[model samples]
Each structure stands twice: as structure tokens, then as C-alpha cells.
Target chain A: MAYELQYYPGATSVAENRRKHMSGKVEKLRDISDEDLTLVLGHRAPGSDYPSTHPPLAEMGEPECSMRELVEPTPGAKAGDRIRYVQFADSMYNAPATPYFRSYNAAICFRGVDPGTLSGRQVVEARERDMEEVAKFQIETEMTCPALAGLRGATVHGHSLRLPEDGVMFDMLDRCRKEGDVIIMHKDQVGRPIDKKVNLGKPMSEEEAAKRTTIYRVDNVSFRDDPEVIEWVHRVFDQRTKYGFKPE
Target chain B: MVNSSDTNSSDTSFLQLEVSPSRLLKPETAQALLNEIVELEGIIRLFVHGPGLPQTVPYGPAKGEPVHHPANTLIEVGGQTMELAVYVGGIRLEVADADVKEQVREVCERVLPVPFEFREGHFIPTRQTVTDYAKRGPGADPVMIGMTDPKGKLKDHPVCILKSESKGND
Candidate 1:
């Protein structure tokens, strides 16, 4: 199975929103549901309750989960609600997942908080901070640590990973984090980071979402050495392929 | 632009921030919050208990100080392991001069408290108040902190570092 790490607002909504004024330019958008491995990040449906002066545009939503409640004005919090989640993007997690297990794909997630305003540059910077903050939460303590929980991909740059100059990349990100940059992923655009943008104006039923494409809600993650974890990724990949929409 | 790998030191420290709940800040009142913080700089001494924490923050009372409001936390001071950003601590700085507060408030997000005089700023600890109700945990400093460097100069309250022995082991 192929998996890619993505950033927020990168995921456009499968459901059309009236308030957003979207013109169907975005295609292959995935559903941010519990069932699908992919998720919708900062990009939200019209009428989403999130506050405007939100910390950083990148932080509104994305692969980060612990922050879901504090920042994201997600619809009612329930078991059925889709979370700010992501997908594996590629076969990186396939057999012999350990080597790949040491790292995660770095992605740049962004969103226009105002929707009416905010230049692309501002959105990019916000993502930088969000990524940094995520790193802090990871190394600082396990209480709200992303590492302690199911690992989530952060937006750190991964330019020279071992496979592609990997050692230097990981070191660089760790260095950035120490300097307080909060480098999460070791590289940039290593793999696909699933993105889901929701436009609230026009909502889609669960059936509509399920019918659109293949999704595998990441139920779990663990040490690649742990055979069960590796086996599970394979199972989820199978399920994703079973229900996932393959590109034509 | 220092990288983490360059550092040979293992000692790491984090900053602790406390927004006076007494202000009764609301998510909507971004401007008031910024104003209150700036104003507090003048009467900063009046607010601190040990006279150390409050003294660490810098007071910019110039009638015509250049406006300083960053949309994101920019690094104010950076060294091997030490860093100080006016907004690095996740506290948002609000200035009434440029209408920065108003623009930030339009969003539903909480505005972070901003800082000034970072490297030269005071050494603010993690916790401020102590109660008989709360349990003291490991890694917490226990002392009636004051503003004095090891040399006994009343140089600055917050920045003055006292040895662990000086603080007295409880």
C-alpha cells in the first residue's frame, strides 16, 4: 500500500460547501471520517465554529489530535466524527517496516483562517510554528506528547534522509527542534500526507463519503519490531485497497 | 539558526508562563489583554510575590516606541541552547498602536501573551503560587526566590540566578 504524509487545508472537502464559494477546482479530496485513514485538517466546512484569532493557521487542524479539542471547532465530538488524521501515503510501512519506522514523512499543512484574506505566505509560516509546537509537545513530556501516543507525522523538512541522505535530515530536524523551531518530520514531501478540506455549505452523507474513495482510518501504530503492528498496517492497507479508490 | 545537533550540552530548560486569571480574560477580549499586559510592565513590581518573577519582564514605557507586534513568535535571542522570543513562549504580544490586536481577534483563537527584553529579560520560573493543597513534585524549585545574582548584586530580580544551595534544600 502507498502512503503519503500531508499538511492541513491540503485536504479539500468531498462535500461541497456553500459559504466557501469553492468552484470544484479541487479533485480526489478524501473524507475525514473515522473509517478513512485520511482526515480533513484546518480546511473545514462552512460554519465551522473555530475561533478566528487561532494560534497559527497551520495549527487549526491536521495530523495533530491532542489539540483537536482546544483549537479546532470540530463538529460535536463523538465517536463518529472524523478527526484531524492522515494516511501512510506509500508502501513505506510495508514489510520490514523497522527502517522506515524510525522516521515519518514531513509535510507542510496550511489554511486560510479568514478564508476571505490571509496570503499564502502567512499560511505557510503558521504551519511552521504548528510543526514546531508539535515537536515541543513530543519531547517535553509524555502527558500531551505525540510520540507517547499513536505517532502522528509532523511538518518537518526531510531533505536528505538515509535513503536520500537520511541521517543528515533527521539530525537537522532535531537540531531545529532544539533551537526551538519544532522540527517534526525530518524532511519535506517525503511521502503523502492525506489532506481533507471540508466546505460546510453543502454537506455529504456518510454514504456519499464512503462511495467517493478509499480510506483507512489509522486505528493503531507501534514499533515496527512489534510484529503485530507491522501485520496490522498490512491489514489496514488491504482494507484501504478494498474500499479505496485507485487512480484511473 | 542554531541546530540542535551542534549543542554538546544535555541540560535543557523550559519557560513557564502564567496569564493572571484575575484579569478574567475572555477569548473575545484580545485588545484588553494586550493592553493590560503592556500596562502591567509599569506597575510590574506591584504584581509579583517574590519580586523576582515580575521583575524579569522588561518595561517599555517610551511614549513613542516603535510598534512591536509579530503575527508569529519570532526569536528575540538565540544562543547554543538559550532562546528568547518576544512571542516564543506561545504568549501573543498585542500593541494598540498598529491595530494588530483587532486583526488577531477576528479569529476565534486565543491570543498568546507576548514578552519583551528576552535575553536580558527576567528568569521567570514555571509556577508562581504555592498552596497547602497542592503536592510538591520532583524537578520543582522550592525557595522564596529573589532578584540577586550569585555575586550579591541586585542586578535584576528575574535574571539573577541563585545556586541550588543558596535556595536551601527543603
Candidate 2:
């Protein structure tokens, strides 16, 4: 019989959202220009050549390794690209993609990706060009809420802070500001002011965010309310304990 | 002849109106609320506290540049001009009795557009503290005890005493 894979098991919306994100089934919501994405990332200039660390793999001539012959190299790896990183700070207040979920999505959806999940922020490091492609997916998909998630390389203190009167997450660096309805980024991720502002489209309404969020809060969809998830957690815990002590 | 000790004997209470998960109230709303609340009788001292708005960008590439927060500006309260440094998060009042507390609540309901709760407690230090003596030096004015910002230099007095001007327009 052909094997079928399951993402997550639960009937609740929060669990469903987790499954969708893990399976990369979320619909693309917005499109950010390559120039804007590069500017916000602050890694290199929009039109500048990606600085390579070594000669291209094609020119270098590969050593006799069976594993290297079996697996195909990524585009950046072929070009001997330098590894770069992009970090996102997701708000705890029902942001669509939390740190853990972001890492899960990257692990399942992309290859040659290194995802690190922190308490307030998540980082993905890959070859420069590859990282930009991943960042574009993250920014343009339902994975990010413009007001709730921030592209901050440092000073990621606003994840748990209360939203400002304007409803956007608090950012001491003031990298982004709301103009009428849309959020605009006026600075790079590292807080250096940029020459032009990148318009990030309108933020989702409270109702939409609540519906799309993967977080389980008592105020929203509580984790305890999902019996399937609770049972699965218990089963995993029991199996770990049972197998840890005595092996068959 | 009255004894000198009798002058110090009196009951006083403080009232605090705090906006939990502090929000930045508009400058106009803050001004209007202050004007109405300060006019009530039995309210002796009024102080507003919240997140400070620095005059300049403290760090990053924009260091030393002026921070243009709309809430951080000069406001007229009870005809007295005062500069607001912080977003109005809480208002502490030295009220004479419970009756004045009720009056303040009425004013809050009519003026404040955000959520707020009032509690009766000693919100400010009534007596001189050790820091006051250490920071202000000896012979510091008793009136400036809990009023001044400790982080601010001696020249920058944060305390403002509101006064009514007979000819001033509202």
C-alpha cells in the first residue's frame, strides 16, 4: 500500500491552521518587490551581485564522493553563494506564524534551509539568493500579518508588548510606520533608515487575524478544547516514557 | 494658644486612575481631562505619568534628532502651560475625601475615551525618601519630594503646579 502522510491531527481551527502552514497549503496574500525585500533584509543592495565565498562548484571540480554525486546542489550552492539570514519577530497576540510554526514551515516546504526558533523570533539561514526566495514566500503568504509580525534583526522586544494605539506592534527602532491604512517600512531590519519606503499593504482585521492565527489561547480557541490534539500529546508522552525505560 | 504639633495632624488620601496595558492618549484628550479634573474642589495635587517621550532619538542612526510624538508637546491645563514628556498612562490625585473621588470619576467618564480604573491608595510617597535626600542634597524643598523625576538633572524640574488665570480662555 502507498503511504499517506498526516501533518497534524485536530478538529479545531488553530490545529487546522498549524496543519495548513506545515503542509505549505496557505494561499499567497501579497507580493513584495525583489528590491523591497532586499532593502528590508539589509544584506546587499537590490541590484548588486551576490558576493561569492568560493569559486562555482562547476569550476572547482568535485571530489570523489558518492553522496555528492547522488544529490543535486541548490542554485546558490552551485554558484558558491555566501550564507545569509533573515529573522522575523512574531507577536504572541494571535499572529499567523509564531516562531515554532515558522521553523516547521521552512523545514517542510524548502530544502537546504536552516531554521532556528527562538522565544520571540525565528531565523532562517541559507545561501544569499535562496534566503531571499524563502523570505519572499514568508512575507507574501498568510504566514505573516503585517501589523503583528516584524522583520527585526535585533531589538526584538515587541513580540509580547501591547499593541500601540494604532494597533501595530511596538517597535522602538521605528523601522515601520502606518500611513493611513497600509504599513510602510522606512528602515532596514537593522534599524538603518532607507532611502525609500516599502508599502506592505493593509493589515488584516481583528476578526481575520483571529480566524487565521495558529496560536491556541484561552481567549480564542483553547488547546484543551481540541480532544484529538490532547490525546495525541498524551499518547506521545506515554510512548516516550514507556520506550525510554524498557525496550522490546 | 494652639500647639505646634496640632498643625501636622490631618487625614489625607491619594487616588490613582491607571490605564492598564498603558495606551497613549491624544494630547487634546489629555488636556481636556486635566482641565476638568483640576477644577474640582478638594483635589490638591495632580500628577500624570506614562512612558516617557524623549526630546531626541536616544540611539541608532537618528541619534540626537528630535522625536516628533504628537502626544509629547506643550498643553494648557487650567490655564497653566505645561510640557508633557510622557504618554498619559495614569493620573494621581491628592484628594481631601471620598466625595472628591466620586467627582473625579464623573470627570473621567465624561472626558476619557479609553478604559481606566480608579483605586484609593497612597500612590505617591507622602514622606521624604532616602533617594530624595541623596539626589536633591540637604535643604531640598519638601514640596519637591515626590514631584521631581530622579533621572532628570536638577535643572529639569518635571513637576508642574497648575494655577487658574482669571482672564484666561478655556
Candidate 3:
């Protein structure tokens, strides 16, 4: 008999959010057009054919490998598309998604992805078309809040900094700005100006963000508040410390 | 533009007005808050603090591109026009005494509708440090002590001197 897979061990909403995110069952909050997402990504121009690194897998004539036959290639891998990346910086101020959570979500949900998580930013790299689909899904889903999360290819500052008066995360490049109720991205992720502004839907309210956040903050649902999470964390810490050193 | 002569005033008490971390102050709001506080008695020095908004992209692929941040603009504060290089999140004030601190707190209460932290402590340096000595030299202006980075250019960190019940603009 197969055992049930529990993503996280906690009774708090923060843990629940983490589990939901890791399970890839998050709600879709907005519908950003593919064209707008592509423009902001800046990896390729809108409606342009994806530049390929090599011939399609079907045409390349692969060797007789059991592993290659067993594993199905992603659409991008099949097409031999160039590798591209999409990076996100989520604010520390009760953002819906955190860097580690974003990486975990990508690893669990996406196929053939290279997800990297830092203290403040998360980057996921895949073939061009696959990366686009991943970026669009993450941007349109509840995991992202326009004001608190930013698409930054470089100079990903302001994740831990205070929000500006406009209630938007500070970007040194000034890629996105708050326009009344919604946030608009006029510059691409790398700070290059796009032809037209992309309208990221309205940001979530502060109260809603707090409720949906996966972070464990003292003011909110802290780590200490969840005993099960604490126990699991201690077990992991103990295992890593005790068995990390093995004589060669 | 603060000079050593202006440091003669005996405003020893220090207080910091920190706005809520969730939001920074807009230029207009910062101006209003500064204007209100400058008019109050006992304030000798005021320093605005927050993350900087660089004029140009400091690094990365688009390094020379203009930032053009809305917060990085000129604002009129205490009858003087100066550039606000950062998003205003906190203000450090050197006042005369406890009574003046109260008055300043009252002014801040009136000016800022959002929740703020009014802290009375040594938030500003009372004397120049070694960095100041190395950068500004022996005859460094006492009034401008500890307010800026020693290695940075003086023009980048302009100090506005607003005398109580006076018309001079420094």
C-alpha cells in the first residue's frame, strides 16, 4: 500500500499555504496575456519563432538508449529550443510567495526545470517556450502579488527593504510602477524599456497577503506557533548535523 | 550647506521619527512633515533616511539607463528646495530638550496620519568620527557631521539649514 504524502506538518495557515504551493494547487488570480508576459521576460520578441539550439529530437536521430525511450521529452526539449530564465524577487513584507517556496513550487510542478533559490530572489531556467509557460503560470497565479513580487533578471534589490509610499516593492531599475489600482511594467526584467506597458493586475490587499503568505514571521504565524513544523525542522537539523560527516 | 558656525546652537537631545515599514513617505508628504517640524522650536539638525534612488542604473545589463524614480525629485522643505534622493522612511532630529521632543512628537502626530515610531535616543552622532576627519579634514563642519558617507561627494548629500524664525536659506 502507498503512503499518503504530506507536504508540510503544521496547523497554521502559513504552513497550509506552503503545502498548497508545494502541491501545485494554487488558485489562478489573474490572466496576463502571453504577449505581455513575453515582452516583460525579454527572452524573445512577441510572435517571433523560438530560436533553436539544435535540430528537433525527431530529426536528430537519437541512439538506442533505454533511458531516452523511457523518459518523455518536454515540448521545448523536443524542439531543441534555447535555454532561458525567469527570475522573481518576492518582498519580505508578507508577500504571497517566498524565494524558497517559489523554487519548491517550480520543482514540484514544472518539468525539466532548473530552479535556484537565494535569500531574496528565485530563478527558474528551462527551454525558451517552457520557461514562458512557467513564467506566465506563476505570474497569473495567487503565488504572486504585483506590489510585493517583481520580475527581476538582475539587480534584484528591495526584497527585504521597505515598500515605497506607493505600496510597491522598490526596484532600483524602476521596471514597474503603481498606476492607481494596478501596477504597470514599462520596462523588461533586464531594465530595458518595452514597446508598451504591461498591466499586471491589482495587487492583493495587505490583510489578504498576510493570510496567504508562506513565510513565518513573529508578528504573524511564527515558526514557534506550529509545533509540528518545529519538530520536523528539529529532526532535519539533527539528521544533518549528526550524519553529515562520514569518513572517506 | 550647513557650516561650523551653525553648530553653536546647543540642541543636544536626539529623536527619531520612523514611519511604518509597510509604506514610505511620498515627496509631498515628506515636505509637509519637514515643514511642520522645522517651524517647531528646538530643532537644530534634521536628517532624512531611507533607501537611495540612484539617478542611473548602478549595475546590471541596463547600467547607464536613467532611473527616473518619482521619489528622486526636488521638494520644497522648510523654505528651501533640495533633491530627495531616497524614499523617506525615517527622520532623525536633534532637538533642544525633552519639552522640544514632545512638541516635535505632537507636530509629527499632526502631520503623519499613519502609525509611526517616536523614539528618543542617540540616533545621530554628537561628534565627528575618524571617517569625517579623513574626508572633511580638520576644519570639518560640525553641523554636517555623521550625516553622510565620508567617501561620497559633498554635493550628493546636501544639508539644508533652516533657522527658527529666520529668512536665510542655506
Which candidate has the top score in TM-score?
3
List the candidate 3 regions with Cα displacement exceeding 4 Å.
Answer: A1-3, A245-248, B1-22, B164-170
For candidate 1, write residues B15-122 as lDDT tens digits.
123332212122223333343443321111111111111111122221232222121121211111211111211132212222333343332133433222212122
Clashing pairs in 2: none
Question: Which lDDT values do the candidates have, in the order given?
Answer: 0.24, 0.78, 0.83
Recovered fraction of real interface contacts per model:
0.00, 0.10, 0.71
lDDT of 2 by residue, B45-70 (tens): 66787666666666644566554555
TM-score, per-candidate, Cα-based: 0.18, 0.80, 0.91
- For residues A82-118, what per-residue lDDT tens digits would candidate 2 score against the true structure? 9999999988888999999999999899888899999
Error of 3 at A186 (Å): 1.4
Choose the strongest candidate by DockQ.
3
Which structure among the candidates has the greatest lDDT? 3
lDDT of 3 by residue, B1-170 (tens): 33434443233434433333336788888889888887776566777888888888888778888888888999887677889988888888677667877887788778875777777666666566656666777666566676775567887776667663443112
After superposition of all CA atoms, the RMSD between model 1 and the true structure is 23.9
Per-residue accuracy of model 1 over A49-144 as CA lDDT, tens digit each: 333333443444456577764665422222123222221111111111111111211111123111111111011122322333322222222111
